[model samples]
Target: MFKTTVTPRFGDIDGLKHANNIAIAIWFEQARNPVFRLFTPDLDLSYENWKLIMARTEYDYVGEMFYGHDVEIISYISRIGNSSFVVTQEAWQNGTKGAIGRSTIVHYDFLNKKSEPIPDDIRKKLEEHLQNEDNSCK
Candidate 1:
């Protein structure tokens, strides 16, 4: 699994003084930089070079997140398919799980405008961080 830390900013706080739901979503996406690097080593955004696209995303809030605390974001591949993979992530703050999320990313050919199968080399790398049924990397 890949882990990242996010420091909540004051602007992220809601009227209730808790981190806003939107902030969690942004944090989750930002924490995915490592995974994005797997497909684009240089983090290039050129249409021709970018090979992955976000197909879906969902999040469930389990607890409140307060500002001035660090949130640990853990991410791992939960499922791998021919043309797509699911990334499962968790947000933990103060030893409590604040949120859980899943993102489906598809490998696609921009020129062809169609989804493509993931390359073997990349697949092997992703397998290295694959999460097992018990929520541990294999």
Candidate 2:
């Protein structure tokens, strides 16, 4: 699994004084940079070079994340398919899991405007980060 830390900004706090749900989503996306690199080594954003597209995303809030605390984000491949894969991530704060999320990303040919199978080499790289059943925030 890949791990990263995000320092919650003061602006991220909501009226309730805890990090807003939207902030968690943005954090999760930012933590995905490593996985994105597997497909686009240079991290290019040009449509002609970008090969991945987000198909769906969902998040479940399990605990409150307060500002002024660092949030640990754990990310790993949960499922791999021919043309798409699922990235599973967790947000932890103060030793408690704050949220769980899954994002479905598809490999595509922008010129063709159709989904394409992930390259074998890229698939193998993703497998290396596959989350084991026992993996979890401690």
Candidate 3:
């Protein structure tokens, strides 16, 4: 379930008088923990078992967000690859899309401590849940 709550923190704001970009990233990270939990408790286990790691991340700010405002962070899987998966996250305020972010995670091996391919079970879960409305059309 996607939970919605008001983010109240004075330090999250920056000199621009709005939520800093880093704060947005932290919010999205907090919001997406459920997805990882749903797939596996020891998310790190997969890297050792299959060799996956978080490869890249990007965020795009759409509207100004301030502290004390109710922020709703929606988390969803976007794309699943043979060795990686992309997670898409969006932050909203009063039903308006305020910011969007995506993270690409790859499988890695702890012994080697390097990037590797994603595991089968996790990939299957990502493929199953990453579906969106538009996916049905395709």
Query: Could you say which candidate leads in lDDT?
Result: 2
Is 2 or 3 the stronger prediction by TM-score? 2
What's the CA RMSD for each of the models? 1.8, 1.1, 4.0
In angstroms, how far off is 99's CA in candidate 1? 0.1
Q: What is the per-residue lDDT of model 2 for residues 59-88, given as tens digits with 9 covering 90 to 100?
A: 999999998889999999999999999999
lDDT of 2: 0.93
The Cα error of candidate 3 at residue 112, in Å, is: 2.5
Per-residue error for 51 in candidate 3, Å, reads 6.0
What lDDT tens digits, residue by residue, belong to model 3 across residues 1-138? 255464748988998789888889899888867666644566555434534457899999989898778788877777877666777877887777788888887655668776656667766666666746243210
Please give the distance, in angstroms, between residue 128's alpha carbon in candidate 3 and its true position after superposition. 3.2
lDDT of 3 at 44: 51
Model 1, residue 78: what's the lDDT? 91
lDDT of 3 at 15: 89
TM-score of each: 0.95, 0.96, 0.78
Which parts of model 2 have CA positions greater than 4 angstroms off? 132-134
By lDDT rank, best first, the candidates go: 2, 1, 3
What value does the lDDT take at residue 131 in candidate 3? 47
Stronger candidate by lDDT (2 vs 3): 2
> What is the TM-score of candidate 1?
0.95
- Candidate 3 — which residues are off by over 4 angstroms? 1-6, 42-52, 132-138
